[model samples]
Target: MGLVLGDAWLWAAVEWSPPAVAEFYIGGGFDTPTVVALLVAALVKAALLWLILRAPAPGPLDRRAKALRRLLYLAVAYALVLRYPIALLPDAVDAAFQLALWTAIDVLYLLVIRWRSRMLRAAAGAVFAVELAAMADVLLDELDLPELGSGYIVELALMLGGVAATLITLVGQRRDGRWSRGTQTAGWLSVGVYALVFPLDVFGRMSGGDMTVPVMMDALGYVGTVWIAATARELPAEGRPADLPPARRRVIRVAVTAVAVLPIIALIHPEATPHLTYTGWSMDCYDRPSFGDLKPAERDAAFLCRARSTEGGVPPMFPDSLSDQEILAYGRALCRAKDRDEQRALLTRAGSASARSADQWDLVYVCPEIVGAAHPELLWSTTEAEAANAAYIAEKNAKCRDPWPRTKGVVQATANYFLFVDGDPGYLVHDPEDEAADEAAEQAMGKVYDDSTRVGVTDSAVLIGHVADVADVCLTVKAFRTPPPQRTAGWDQVNEVPIVSRSGQLTVPEMGEGGEVGAGAPMPNLAIAGKGRYRLRVYVRVDDAEEEQHLVVVFPGASRKRLKLKPRPVAGRALSFNSPSSGGRRAVARGAGGRSQAELWS
Candidate 1:
């Protein structure tokens, strides 16, 4: 009784069962059917064991009987302790430790079993010792010994030993004259089943294969336990009655068979259906408003017909009055009628134009007849407003398209020019008075610009500049209309500007101490022949660093006015004049010194 209780508790704690179906019997939290079943089964078995324990003793307790009773108590205690606390250890350690403890308990139980001969006990002991060694290897991660090669050899040896033990035990049981033929045959059969199942189970686990074999072994083990408990008791002396009555024995056998079959049934049962809330198309057609007037059977038939047809299959049963094609057509028409009626009902409840929702507008757009009768002007006005808004956006986008050529360094007449310098705090302009001031200004400028530059476009100009440290600089020039706000509204609002043309890499050498480098010529032949302000933006990059600057040139509608050459800092880089300009064209030079030298000539 103690052994049975302990085994039951151990199995429950570990949840030893088939992988795919184990959840149906042992998983799910409290309140689930499977968990409830397990609790009921456990309580019933516990109650039965309690009744058995309460029964009168058969005879005086011998040393072997006392030892067996103590061992049972010990097994129960060990199981309870491990199940609660010790099982919390790391998986490998917990499994290995549990196996070792169980192995010890099994050896003790075997010693108390009162085997017919010493030879049989010895064989069993040898098999258990081999099993214990294999378990130890598992505990140590297959011994981690190079010569062992994954511990398969040790497992195979243990399997062979188990085979030998099973054969010897069967032969010994057959030869014994103390027990009845029925008992010996049952013992041999149980041993044979175990011998076959155990190896297959071991191999399945080692190879990580399918669990069907292990599940079978578990079922067989349950039956074997019942058989061992029923037949392994000592026989009464000559002319004595059996320990249990014939009727009781038959009842026990029937009960044990039922108990063993329950788990197998649970293991093989189909998985529970997942609970899902029905929504949208999955909602039953019978629940729709259209089905309110129909009879229950008619409603069911309609839903079934629609469901089957929706799945692209013929309905099993159709209306007696309708053909197959007519049934399908009728089902589809009913569904569409219900949808249209429901949509109209919703629009009606939403009231006239003042209270209409987005869904009502959508319905009106698709089926104008539904709401257009009451709110014709509202629908017409909405349609015109949407068309106008779309047209406005399209016109703005058309005006913002790329307005420059694709070629590098090929400046067009309408193209604006920009310049920028790349460094940390960006472009620095210093006006040093003396050599000492120049050195001081150079240090200050170095601290300011460090390793960065500035680049971008303004109202009507493109200013492209580069710092001296930069080895290679690429400038991409893009044009945007500056006046007539509606024409450039889209480009003005967006963060990403459109690229019109690229200047490739304007490769420049490292600046010599006394020499000046021309950044680039002014964008020549600009065709700014419109009333609007035109701007050119230059995207400058020194190596991998980015800088942006812009230059704006306004065309006052063909008026020839002498525009002053005001050196303004555009996008943080100072525009400086190196020499005097007599003609209208401004000749700009980027110098190494800290200051710009400008001479104005008329």
Candidate 2:
């Protein structure tokens, strides 16, 4: 007993560690303590039943008679309560069904043991067959064939055959007074083994594998149950002790049978993480809407834009700005700026030219770096005043029992467009009164655009802007890469910066420091051919520290004339970018200036 208990202890210790046990307890209905208690109870019950069956036969309690009684007891437990519970839980519900499956398989083993009469054996086999079929069905489903859901005829045949065989045997052995001691023990032991293996299946599910442990356990349980039944009902083997009570023998048989199941259960959890698991983004978000219940398009758009804005720039993978050669010229000038003042002046001149060009040609453009800052307004959101107003509107919905929590701070600024207002201060009108008062409020606080108009469609709470066709005009922006007010210096210590598109793919060619790196110097300008979309994906690395990447997409048809957004500082160690509208010929054409080719212009 000590050795047996030690084996159980040692194995369980390694198999069910604290973390694994806790996860099991939380994920399943039963905790470790309760499961242990149940396991102990099962052994005790089996032992007691075995003891009863093996007790000395009073008067007419012959071997055959005792077997009949055992068979009757096991049969009753099956038809009504035992068998059905296995099917009670829904398929998607993992834990409860798993428990039921193991319990049912164990029951089959027990039935096979207590019934020695050929008829009773057949009856038990029938029940086992039904369960076996079900197990097969489960396996086939795991294999993932489209037809598996419909039902497998082979499984059905096995189940029906077992049922028929059992019925015939029961009729022929109607009066058999013997139960198979071997089957009874085998069945009980099989269950104990199943108890150990059950958690492994659950763990597999957690690690994203199909739960097929039950089927495997059932297969082994079947053989053990049959063997136990055969041993229990064995005819006095020539020199065997005929005086031994049937019940006692049944207990001994079951105890030994349980040993057969131990190794299999112990081996269940060792399989490594499956080759594939449906976890990560697919399980969490892609399969269903995780955040707000937005549509696929809306979510995709929001996600792409938010990602770009977060990095403070649009993706540069697609060159929507001046071509590589032209950008190289600008880059050369930018890198040559010796002092902070010089850097700012050089960047400002380039930025102004880009901005004016964007404005004049209606071409979307972005200064790779303005004042040594790329996309300084990415973090900007609705102001507190506007947030308060949105809250007020939300309260109105709350009062009406149609609460729609105001998702304030939902506004995001795009590269070519700015978010002017999401929920601006005084955005919602709570009161309507005299004509004069209403007129004043409307005149003073009327929104310039609504949701639709904000995106350049209809009036809305959000607004975006883009350059118009032929909006080419040179405008300068200042840069302060170095510390405060200093004299302008030409590029000297700057290094070439490469931009990337939204896909993390590099777009522009390496640009060197052109002599153009001067404050108030005109940046190489380019024009958009038509109402095409574009994004400026720029990578800026100053003084060889870290590279800062920005991706911006400009939807000419979407933006308004101008957007009002607070300039916010970029707050990350490494800045990256992505924009959806930065692909294809929508980008700026190279070589617009007379002297320099597009590739060599920058």
Candidate 3:
């Protein structure tokens, strides 16, 4: 029975992941290979047990043999019962059922052995009781009553009980006339092997270390079981061994003791054993191809091919067979080419169409850098290259100006501004400055600028000029109370002044050209209370314009004065004004108002 149980554990450790015992009867997932393998193994074991039972008794059968026969019968019955029903149960229920089944088998064994010897019976009964209690404890643990700590306590008791039972069985076999010397030796050896290996196997499993120790122990245990079974069959009914020579007896005892101590020493100092080294690739290198074994020419060709396969325009290939000097010369010439087209032509002429072979993308990208390291003169300065490339791109964009509508009045306003209308869709005011051009281009392409045009006021007359066309223009001249200038150090620093109140849009005709549009008089209700400098702002929207005209009206006691407007590019947006501080002040006020208010101010 001990040998049979030991074999079961040994097979479990050797043949299964998470051990076969868990997968066989308890683990869910019936379609798994593990469950099928276990079922097949159980069937094979049952067939073997039947064959063993049918085999003729070697001489007249003893009490031990009869007990073994009964145990074998129970084992076969248990295997058949567990094979189908246990597999069908839920995982938790299956685990509990397996535990109960094993405990019942142990109890039955205890009952069978009781008639043999009183001391053995008591020990086996105690072991059985302890095992049953341990099963109950496990079931309770699964229920999560952790305060009980029944798992640990019951496990310890179960181990002690097993040890006691083993000792009592050994004593009974020795004293009773049912075992031979060979059988006794085999039985003790089996026990000794189990004692040495089982704990180490358990520890290895718990600690999650290498399975080598447990596997070695399991093999040793199987050998011991085989030895015990063979010796038991050959032994006589009156199972006492023939007397052995003193020297041979001492040698056998010494060998057994040495075998038992070795596993203990190994468990205590595992590092003393030689370990197998893993040579698998690291995480970073796993995806990359190893070119260490490839020829230099082949490696280079592979790199070139890889670069071509990646998304993006394929770069012209370089020859794999080029010498370092030749490679350096080629790289220098490629870098110094007048343009990208010239570089592409030079690379195309030097490369062979048939020689393309893909390698790592990174290697291909850095191929020039790799060869250039040998001759620093051949390596292009990255900073210089980047600056030149940027200048070239800017020049190209500057030359590729958008074709504006040819209108009689539309002329390049100064060198930086131009105004034109494309049919009646809208008027366009473009600033020749690169930043402004880019913004105008984006607005032109998108064609949705309802909130783009706006108006605002400064200390002078209302400045208005972001109109795309004057056709859709509307001027709202409002009188706003200007906040008191912030005082710093007892003197007003005039840091900021904000609009406090306003009237509705003044009745003024749509603006057309530069003329006396609003009687050229100070618009009524445009004056604020107190000695504050009041200004009237005219709001206008040219068709599809991203900017609004902000005309500032200045009143000098009932008379309106118009200031000369000079449109200048300020931070990519064109603001038509002559005052140097107007842009900065307007920006500060707009920023203070936050985004929505800033949009309104604009």
Name the candidate that leads on lDDT.
Answer: 3
For residues 1-602, write the lDDT of model 3, one tens digit per residue. 31255434534533433344533533333333433444455454444344333332356655755555445444444443444565666655755775765565565445433246676677667766765665566666666655223355555676566445445555655655455554466556666776776567645754553434544453454434333343334434543346668888888788678777866775563543322111121122223332333455555433333323323334334433443334445555654566656756765666734233322122432354544444332233335434443443334234322211132111111011111111122222222222333333344424423223222222221223343322122222333343221112211011121221222222221112221121112223333353334333222222235323222222213223422122222334443312122222222111111121112112
The better-scoring model by lDDT among 1 and 3 is 3
Write model 1 residue lDDT over 1-602, tens digit each, in one string.
31245433434433432233344432332233333445444454454334323322244555655554454444444443445565566667665665656575556546544567777778677776766665565666633543322455665785565445445544544454333443444455455555555346444644453434444454444333332332333222233223456776676566546544544553342334211122123435323222223454454344443422223232222323233344334334333344555534443432312221222222232334544565443344434544543443334233321232443223322211111222222221211122243343334433322212222222222222343233222222322223212222212111111111111111112122222222222233222332232223222221223222222222123222222122222344433221222211111122112213110000
The global Cα lDDT (0 to 1) of model 3 is 0.39
Each model's TM-score?
Answer: 0.28, 0.21, 0.30
Error of 2 at 414 (Å): 27
Name the better of 2 and 3 by TM-score: 3
lDDT (Cα atoms) of all candidates against the true structure: 0.36, 0.31, 0.39
What are the per-residue Cα lDDT tens digits for candidate 2 across 1-602?
31244434322332222333334333434334444544554454444345334433234444554564455435433422354554455543433343355445335344433354666666665555565555555654544533223434654564454434344333322234343434434445544555555455555555453323432443344433343334334423233324348788876766665565655664544334222222222222233222223443443333322212213232321122333334334444544455546644654554432221111111112222332243222211225323443343334223221011231111111111110111111111111222243333343233323421112111111112211111111111111111122111321111111111122121111122221111112122111222222222111121233211121221113223332221222333222222123221111121111111121211
In Å, residue 190's CA in model 1 sits off its true spot by: 9.3
Off by over 4 Å in 3: 1-68, 73-120, 139-154, 197-211, 221-255, 267-602
Candidate order by decreasing TM-score: 3, 1, 2
